[model samples]
Target chain A: MPAVIPTDSVGLVHPQTVDFPEPLTLECGRSLPGYTLAYETYGTLNAARSNAILVCHALSGDHHAAGYHSVDDRKPGWWETMIGPGKPIDSNRFFIVCSNFIGSCRGSTGPASIDPATGEPWGLNFPMVTVRDWVRTQAALADRLGIAQWAAVVGGSLGGMQVLEWAMLYPERLRHAVVIAAAPRLTAQNIAFNEVCRQAIMTDPDFHEGRYYAHGTKPRRGLALARMIGHITYLSDDAMRAKFGRDTRNGKAFSFGFDVDFEVESYLRYQGSRFVEQFDANSYLYITKALDYFDPAAAYGGDLAAAFAPIRASVLVISFSTDWRFSPERSREIVQALYRAGREVAYAEIEAAHGHDSFLLPVPQYLAVMSAYLERIAQESGR
Target chain B: MPAVIPTDSVGLVHPQTVDFPEPLTLECGRSLPGYTLAYETYGTLNAARSNAILVCHALSGDHHAAGYHSVDDRKPGWWETMIGPGKPIDSNRFFIVCSNFIGSCRGSTGPASIDPATGEPWGLNFPMVTVRDWVRTQAALADRLGIAQWAAVVGGSLGGMQVLEWAMLYPERLRHAVVIAAAPRLTAQNIAFNEVCRQAIMTDPDFHEGRYYAHGTKPRRGLALARMIGHITYLSDDAMRAKFGRDTRNGKAFSFGFDVDFEVESYLRYQGSRFVEQFDANSYLYITKALDYFDPAAAYGGDLAAAFAPIRASVLVISFSTDWRFSPERSREIVQALYRAGREVAYAEIEAAHGHDSFLLPVPQYLAVMSAYLERIAQESGR
Candidate 1:
């Protein structure tokens, strides 16, 4: 196994943006003249440069996967629980890279980004991007960083789609792929939820056909409602029951009005309101469309196993028992397909109550399983 | 057993409004000086007035329970399938009375109703009404109609809550109570979904604090979004997959833009948009609050069995296997409580692909079971 780096070396990190001047083609047959990607890096690149791991984030997540963006940040990077020195993804031995996707709002070129021709935000003019486009863009970033092959590429949910894409589209570029709490392709129910969320944003008067930036207003309410809907799905019934359990917000009796009476309601409202401050409504639209459009099996003529037939990377698939968004049955589809394709793969159905969000939380068994798997990758690479 | 009436006797019906001149007290400690309830009757009440069956409508449902108000109407009543002649409820054998609940806007006194004192739409000024309050108002309507006792009180979903309330609060008034696809109380997850729907409408600028009637503009987009969210939850995953799969709207390939790409998206958008034309947003708020506040067990100090202990009505509880909104487990809570309370109860867990809406749909097995149960009620009541 690779030697663990000293814990003292891991600390706060800053994000950096890279400009790709070369034109890029999208899966939708559209071309972008140029784009910029915001990314963050942790730990160090080993002498052989063979110990690098690429981290992909889920929807609403950004490049700050680990460490605090500032000394006084109320919360550390989303994945801080698992990516510090000696942590699960262990920035100790392997250099880690996380980047906000092309159609995201966090310092990335998205609908909120300036258009070269109009000198206004791309808004509705931005071309639709797919999981394949994001993976290809990330590959380009890897090339710019002088890393020929990543030791592992890991992600959960939408991020997991990108990891699967990496294994399929650029098999030689990744040695290992970890997909957590994600489906091979979105189910009909998944698409339905995404559509409702998109409708929420687009129907907002302030959306102004996704040109809210020009109007000097944001679709805060629509974006917040979308987030509230999302937050509910991210949690399990058991988790919500344990957390709020029909408890009144301020007293033991019902307020008998439209006020946030229940603690769960208040919590959801807070989540929705807080999310709007950080997320772009148009980016939400674009990213969810990308998720709904993802169907590797379609590219392989509806044969999922065929999509994995040419992959050389060993795979790790993890699912939470309570993740109704992408249930364990969905994860089993990918594992079964990988097995049918004769790929080396590890599977774990972690016991968790946090639902789909369990992948980002610090569940002991989830962390330990991931940590053990990463150790195996380091040993196999002779890092 | 009472003789079945002629099938021709049950067909299209017109609604009648009943105005109460006296004040009605609500469970929320508020009072409405007077209110009107719009109702429709099918079949004839027996000479003794003991054969009357009160049918409560769910959220988004109104008094037009089993017929078209006019020949040119696009659709018959929402539950026309299960309540007409020779149907499961068998209006021929039971005089069925369906009423538009007080908070509803379908010719019923609600937020859209003019306040006599202010000479304006009540709007947000309308007092909150709970499930218990609705049942009480309904009981008063029964008295005004000269019905000494109702042979049965039937409802599903939110309506089912009213049925449960009838069994608990007006035990002597109803001899039989059928509660379908309901729970002892709203779970935290249930409340969360309701909160999101309410937020969608309340956040819309067009809502204008529920005074949209005065503004001459409606919160159509917000209401549509709320309905879209609701329509998703009403159908099971299997149902959506069977109905829509990954089929694109009018095309085999994705549109590469946000133009209702999926058939499910189109269906949901249609459901949302069409719902706004017939429903009132403030009524949505008030009714959901009643649903969220419905907790007979809470009122009885969290002892569900104790809450049902004093009920004299025989109970029939039905649940769909795929209803995640009020899952079988939630329905079982009511069944188990009734059992513990030593009430005469029958429980059926129907195999179904539709979710909560299974109660509203024409499922053969569900209708068969309900038919058999109602037959038993008829024989016992000498209807």
Candidate 2:
């Protein structure tokens, strides 16, 4: 384990890459061969390399977990609150690694990746990916980094799915696991939301059976519509009311014509339009399917507890109060399974109204709980 | 008034049509010059023509309020519960009439209707219409039917808007009015929902900017997406949970791909697809804008009480307990204004889980209340 202290002048670190191979061949019977994984690492790796903390991201998140780049100009990573100096997953105490998932379009091999054989964008021909496949890829990356084990693996929502997978697949490799605002499998409603988005994208005339790029057309409108629908679920009714209750966009009177009307409309439109610039619609299709197919307990003969039987990691499971898409009830299910599996665990349902995105919000209680947990683990690890 | 107890063969017959041309001309500017109104009557028209009743329809609703078409299998009018032989708006006594509003894709003149001079579809050339314009057209139809005044004018939601418009524009035309689950004007949220739908239609590449008829392409995807968005609002969260939960369509396991994962997805897809078959995208744009622009009170100097100043009608307003879109508070606002205007009125907020569409659903209390109110009015009129 590394000494739990920070150095004043490490300056900025650059993101690096590692090679990983697909775990199991696709149902289509073809192995994906070797693939490149993009990741960013902060802090230092100890001689023992046991103080590593893996960070998983949500559906649209990237590997930039914290800090800013002079060139990129993007905001300091999505989870800067709990990942920086003296923070919850303090860089001074652990080597933090955040990797873009394989099925993601963010510099990863996804539906938009080039096909080795066809010599063109994979498009719809990309092989289906499951959560297990994603975890396996991460494991390969850990191996290349000489990280035989990790102090903890933490993630929220879809990221939490990866954390659960880590506990199930390589229990001996991690000392603690944190899963937040996630489910054991795709719920019917979750599936419904994904399906509607897919239908919206696939049915767009511009989609052209996913050969949109060949025809020099983009399913931007369809993708935008999908984002709008998904954005609604990402928020709670109360949040929406507080954010934009009956607030007109342009004027008070109705235009009696086709135009943006409410502030919320303008907000959603901006979200959808802006998203299309950096996102690939094909990647959305593939990744959404990966989430829909996730079932950590299915491989364990229907016993979720049995699935975590091998894990030796103490677990910290967190959920948000207002995440309708992945509610607290879902988090409780994971906690119950971990308990039944006899794993050492801590559970907390944070009081936050930010829906599934609460984990990223600046909630004081969340930080206090995480800081205490990380410090306690570092003391036990003994650098 | 005609004898209340005596009517021989044809239940009630007072169908009439009149010319309507006032205010501003349509976008086509071919002054409506001489408008031809079409309407059907129910009960016998009293000698004084004061026993006539008016029924308004929602966005896609038509004038067929009851009974099956002699030669068609499309079923009875959308609202058959309160408009039949012994029902609330009893055809046995009150002469009821329902007419499709202008800008509707139905038999009424709309974007799909041919221009008188150009002999081509009005298409984008149809002048934008306000809720007030539709009401004016309906009032003209009432005059042609020899109806100097109505026993009552009744409607729900958008239909309710028409009822309020009637009270404002032609107070002497009705002795009483019933408004159900409606607002005085479009709130910011209401306008937002409408704007998204309009954008969905206009952005569709197949829409061809409202001239796709010659291209053999229809903006079906946009229309479907619009309907899907609308469907979400029409339903309550509790209703969605009770009806769809997380149940997948015909499977216990996710297909691990971009297929319908939940029952809700199938339901929404079915709704959206079905809507496209029956509705014109342009008409959707026009009608939704009408609803969004409605503000009878605002047009009357921001005082709802003043708006009802000319209304001689005794009013009855009803609201469903679960209607979030046009909540009971909105109905209360209308009732308060009528009361402030010194108008005779009855108000009821019925308990139902069906939300804003509850008026269109089966509810014993709603029907019972209507029956009691009508009988009381009939006795007072001595038709």
Candidate 3:
């Protein structure tokens, strides 16, 4: 790809890792001794180090939240449309720190990371990590970066879960919490989908019980199938209809065999194949597990309102109308709980057809809401 | 499992196969030399032979549409709740012919059927079947049964597609069409989900290119995964939340590994495993292919209203409130199209939480609607 970075783009950026020698305790009652978090910084931290915004990523997202990794890179980071110099996130006005979650394969401590004791990839040996655990690691990264508090903690989808965790676990670390297209917990249907995806990965012979790293051959088909399942959930029915419909590949009539007939099938197959190229199957297992275990309200007698006791950060919950995966109702659940807890919370249901993935897209009204909300944060509570 | 049949049950039944010796041409430009269709009958044909109702089965469904297989049978047929002496379908009032579709794994001519020429299972060699093709076969079966035309053709989900096809392709063959929770055509999202499930089966190493019988072992994992995926789509979010919720299996704590943690996951896993025991992987491929090819409107210049030109049967369409798989809006498409064609059509949106499976259940309102509609069909058009 040519150097076509837009004027408002975050432009060229580099990733960095912050190491922590201290053991990190996990919600699963396990600990990782001396781990590292890979992250990328955009713009600059203010003199007081309070202007930093913690940008968390969804499942399978990495440290590169925005900007071109290199001139030859085909696509900029995911959410690039939402995070740029003059965009809703406005990299120019706020220092942004986007980090790979601890259980991610993106140069972070995860299943694919090497164990210090055995000098081998942790594989299945890696401790289970939760949203709270990820939030704790992000907090450590903030401390290492000398930022006592963030201007705002922002994310969407699973990333949005982290934003909530920050408010629940380390509420004083951020002034604004932007939880976009997230649910406070996984529903039975949600867990069922996750379980099915995991089964797709685990059932593959090449999966080798998540120790495929030793075998040198990963379960590509399983991982691909898992991604395909996830992809369908990410896009709304309207989005798929608009993009593919019943159109066939090359306008070909039904081949009458077990080959691709509809364009949607071909599209899903292509996306599934592409996913295995960059994602680790073992890490997918860990990520989904974390998602299933994200109900903080469970500890409060299943009362979300009661679980918001630790929140000090002002919350902004945004939902897309067509996001059936994490529907607008889920956002309202968070809003209702926050309100019941007497915490400051704002909610806006954006009308978008992209479904759960709308959070990463540049929907006009969505962008406007974010810009207005962040601007108010910058002006009224300047760091 | 003793003879515990209910008072109103159809009681023990036997499946019968009708053999056809003529070539069956498919829309895919292929033909089956000869075929056999397994079916079960409940209620005797009247003297005028006009009380016959052809009951279509959905994807993965079989000929046993109602009644107990034997006195030792543990459960009745899939739709036992709705079809009996005093049930909505009222086996006593209607001569019900529930036959396995041409491309299904039941006692029918499908991929797993033995080829007379080769003395082996057809497997991948089986000609692709469509909804119209299935309807044609049903017509042939009706000719064999000495029923000139059915009183009503009834089905739901993929089965419901057959009812519409009966109306469209063989407009004069039936007097009434009762389509429940069926879409006029599959949306892009619908096709995408089907594709993923197909991929799950096709990609399994044990699939052996749809000739898994040659391997003496089937792609159990792939078939199981596909069923797991399908099971999730069968129910609505609210349905699942009400049934399983986030409850863990046996109320156990999360094991923090790639194992079943939630009750929903456990239920899906069991459903998948059980499915693999009864279903043929190759048959699954053909069934989903049929579902994807069921867009009659595509031939009518993508106008469903135009597609209704061939549907002469009086139609009674029903939809459940939470059937997101084939939403109530889809049923409206059929109703609107029938209206445009100046055809008699009745529409009912049953307020039930069972989702797509609601059609098979004995919801009081849904049963009342079915009973009332069929009563009208019987009395007004008596032979």
Candidate 4:
């Protein structure tokens, strides 16, 4: 049995690792002698090799973007709905590559990766990787993969930051850039939330000052608390109210005790526990720092337009109405910057109650806009 | 020297304790054998005893609601901005009382209070207290003060919740109820946040299952984290942005390491540290639990109008523009329910960017509304 692949899915796929053996300098002025990136690609390239689209994953995301890895796999990748045969990215029309970002823990060389020098997990010894560092590593990966110029580079949230960086760092490498649910830089409140999450992880006793890998333990409790807080920010107040409201876990009676009383509490706790099982606390620290440090306008005297001037890619920005984390206003700021820089930019503000997580969901309006814009890109690239 | 008591101030004030030795039944079906409520009063009750107004304090608040307790006090009480002789609360006109809630640590019978049976702090053994229980305690305090009825009941946040409870528990006891920045019940998101805070404290090694008092230590890290999270929620996003927008503690260069990159992180950490010094971890647990449990419509078959139908007090509901913690929409819900119950109600949604803390600020519009409402009440009561 070849494992009945669903008609809409890209089907069973495998991840590939590409090694960079040369020393790579990071934005923090540190250097990694070598590293590896785990990636998965779908679809095929045309003779001109211009049909490729690079997909960037957000914080806590991985290379798996559209298909299952095995027949018994319970769930597909994170953005399956928007990256199938006839979906928005349309695997049938364009070759796609999704790679796990460097500072992330998903099969990528991150803080949890073993350092050859010490024969131990890098942990805090890992150089502080910025969005620019991730982009630079990704640019090298693209070179190794022979992707001279991508038909489009697309991502959401932190992934979206990478797309913006691609536009600035390698102006001619991406013909089209799709930035979804991202900000040019984090707001004070966003930084505060990230700081809290970092505090939660760093404070856990098992954390051992980020040396828990040798302690044969993990900062599970602190990581769980961080994830729980993150989950609250991911959903809108209306979404949470509709999903759980005052609904108790056991029955109508209040627990009185500090056990799980509301369904939302149970949901958050479960999310936290599950996250701790799969996530590296050190990676969470590094990745959130990257998110907090990324500012497109920081180097250009705080002028967004001046920062955006180097971009040659035609930009498309998308935002959700209720996403307080990366609000529509943020997307508009990106669009405004693009306009000021004389860049061709398209924008759509999708009305959705899912909040920051709306970027991951298959919102009809959101998908429609993505499909419509990418369709034009597909034609323009002769895919 | 008497510390130059300003003429417009209430000058000096002190908290008084009233004992209730009889068993006090809690809404959770538990009973406290004996307890004492700590309270403060300003001004004098008129001959008719109808000039008194009950002022409820919110979570983390105390009975020291106004003026200075000692000559060299660095700051007056929490509500000093609006509680002086000529302020909106107007101690010159109304006899004001603010009592610490029973589940709180501030000079009240709370989790930190000595358990008479074991001669240890109640800790986790403290009987779960509800808003209704708080109202009952306030009613007893009223009796002890020789006041039969209050001209008005006023509070903000959890205190606002107490005002609502007073209207329901003792309809004739309060002629007017002023609810500020409060929801009728905690939303699922609200509960989720509280649950995370509780989880942080409980998981800390020093927590010792809420018996930290006996262990001779406190969950300082967990409690600090909880307060940091709370502080973020207290301010509106716009307020935070205006106050601390990526302003680094050590100039423009990012710290890269986790010490304190942004000014917001530093401020939150300072707040968390200060809160741990003045607050009890066990009380934080119990009080947040009470916040999670309160629901006026729970007993009335989820009917807000039915829950409010027995109320005889004229209700005044006020909310701030950016109070996502307890938004303006929630206040409107209260107003709508009061109208359905045929209760006299007035509503105001002040345009302020302080978020949930707007209720505590001396916003011009908010103060004007309060002064106008209380002025009418004062004239009607002939005080």
Give me the candidate number with maximum lDDT.
Answer: 4
Give the Cα lDDT of each candidate.
0.89, 0.77, 0.89, 0.91
Instruction: Evaluate residue B142 in candidate 1 and report its C-alpha lDDT on the 0 to 100 scale.
Output: 95
CA shift of A138, model 1, Å: 0.9
Ranking by DockQ: 3, 4, 1, 2
lDDT of 4 by residue, A1-383 (tens): 14577798998889899988888888888899889999999999888989999999998889999899887788899899889899999999999999887877888898899999999999899999999998888888889889899999999999999999999999999999999999999999999999999898898889999999899999999999999999999999889988898899866577788888889989999999999988899999999999999998987889999999999999999999999899999999999999999999999999999999999998999999999999999999897
CAPRI classification of candidate 1: high
lDDT of 2 at B282: 86
Across residues B1-383, which tens digit of lDDT does each residue of candidate 4 receive?
14688787788888898889999989889999889899999988888888899999888899998889888888888888778787887887899998888988888898888889999888999999988899999999999889889999999999999999999989989999999999999999899899999999999999998889888899998999999999889999999999898899868588678889899999998998999999999899998988998899988889999999999999999999999899999888889999999999999999998899988888999999999999988987786
TM-score: model 4 vs. ground truth: 0.98
Q: Tell me the fnat of candidate 4.
A: 0.85
Identify the superior model by TM-score, candidate 1 or candidate 4. Answer: 4
- State in Å the error of residue A366, model 1: 0.8
* Residue range A56-168, candidate 2, lDDT tens digits: 88888888877754444445677878788778888888889999887778877877788788888778877777777888888888988899898889998889999988988
**Candidate 2 lDDT score at position B159:** 94
lDDT of 3 by residue, A1-383 (tens): 34577888888888998888888878899899879899999988877776788899999899998888788888888988888887888887889999998999888889998889899889888999999999988988888889898999999999999999899888788999999999999999899989999999988999888889889999999999999999999999999999998899999988998888888888888999999999999899999999999999999889999999789999999999999999999999999999999999999999999999899888999999999998887775453
RMSD of each: 3.4, 5.9, 1.2, 1.5
Q: Write the per-residue lDDT of candidate 2 for residues B1-383, one digit (tens) a residue.
A: 23341232222333344445444464323455334444566667888776788889887677766554443334456776677677788887888888877777766777877767688777777778767777877776776677777788889989999998888788777777889888887665565557667777888888887877767888898898888877776765556767886566885566555657668888999999999998888889888877866766765668989887888878899999878778788899988998999988899999987778788876899988888988877876676
Per-candidate iRMS values, in order, are: 0.8, 3.6, 0.7, 0.7
| DockQ, every prediction | 0.83, 0.29, 0.89, 0.87
Model 1 chain B: ten consecutive residues of lowest lDDT: B1-10
